[model samples]
Target: MSTPTVVLVHGAFADASSFRALIPELLADGIPVVAPAVPNRSLNGDAAYIASVVRQIEGDVVLVGHSYGGAVITVAGVEDNVRALVYLAGYALQEGESLGELQGGFPDSALATALVQTTYPLPDGSTGTDVSVDPTKVHDVFAQDVDPEITKVLAVSQRPLAAAAFGEPASAAAWKTKPSWGVVSSSDNTINPDVERHGYQRAGAKIVEIDSSHLVMLSHPKESADVVREAIRATDR
Candidate 1:
């Protein structure tokens, strides 16, 4: 069979470039990759958007979601061409569950206190709240393993997730049907690592625990790439 496309879906507070380090490794290994910018609007909308992207691809695809992206692929991976899923410190949410509902079951992490919420205007003249890590605490709350200088840039360029997204229920969970793998960022500050472990366990995904921050693909790209490869080998049938 032909090689499957590896579609990297990034979570809130990040964009496609979040996979910069891991992208190179996948490319060097002759793996085709596509890291798309996810609109952190709502769970249903983001999943529909990702599913559309997958539908446009020509061959089998492997979805790799980071953080919120994990939740995206959980809904999108049901696409017929999607062969597998790899969650890199991502949320493998269950059907009808909201991010807030899942996270609420676990104790709040540093992110709860570090969050900086602000309002943004909508086309209808209404406003909605966006949540991001306080820029001053971005390093400790997001990815402390990354360089301070990088975190400085991360602070300014980071994308904020729509607060409504958290409470919005997930319409579908592809992990329920697809072959899946999960990585736990054991040292994550933004999300309680237990949350990651619990979600993966529920999904029955092969789990890997890595000592790193929320940005596992950035700090542990080699190990990250290894798991992606393993997922491909096991499911690229």
Candidate 2:
């Protein structure tokens, strides 16, 4: 059989660069990978954008999303070249569910307050703000397994999600029909592990628990990639 293509979707507060560490490993194994930059400000536009990318792909694809990107690909990538999905410390939404509703499902945590920022309106009627995480907190909240220098860069490089994106509901739940795989960051503070567990339950996705933080792909790239490869292999059987 030909190699499976992997289209990665990053979560809120991040872009396609979030998959930097994992893509190389997967590519080395002869698996093609694509991670489009998501428009963190416009959820609907972002989903439509990603959907276009999925539609352009040439072969059987495994759609992977991290955090809010999980929700985006669910709505955009469901009926494309995508044959399976991998949620890497990501969200899973059912039909009619929005990211904002999922956020409200659990009580606030340290990460919730950390996400707040001052928003300024733009000439285009959109808004913008800074998304900088404290360097020290990066290790505790994200990839603890990776190099300290990596988190140092990540702390400064974090992207902020637009307030409007969270309110966009899922166009449809991809998990309901697609075979899915989920990687849980047991120590994640950003998206409550409780919330992640809830997503896993809702999707009925095959589960793999990693004792890491929110950025499991960066912290545990090999393991993260392994589970994803396994997910693709499962489809071949």
lDDT of residue 184 for candidate 2: 88
Candidate models: Cα lDDT each: 0.93, 0.80
lDDT of 2 at 68: 81
RMSD after Cα superposition, model 1: 0.8
Please give, for residues 1-237, the per-residue lDDT of candidate 1 as tens digits: 568999999999988988989999999989999988999998889999999999999999999999999999998999999999999998999999999999999999998998888999999999999988889998988999998988888889988899999998888889888989999999999889999999999999999999999999998999999999999889856
All models, RMSD in angstroms: 0.8, 2.1
Tens-place lDDT digits, model 2, residues 113-209: 5654657687899766634445567666666666888777777776777776777777788788789999888888777887888898789999999
Native-to-model Cα distance after best TM-score fit, residue 139 in candidate 1, in Å: 0.8
What is the Cα root-mean-square deviation between model 2 and the actual structure?
A: 2.1
Q: What is the number of residue pairs that collide in model 1?
A: 1
lDDT of 2: 0.80
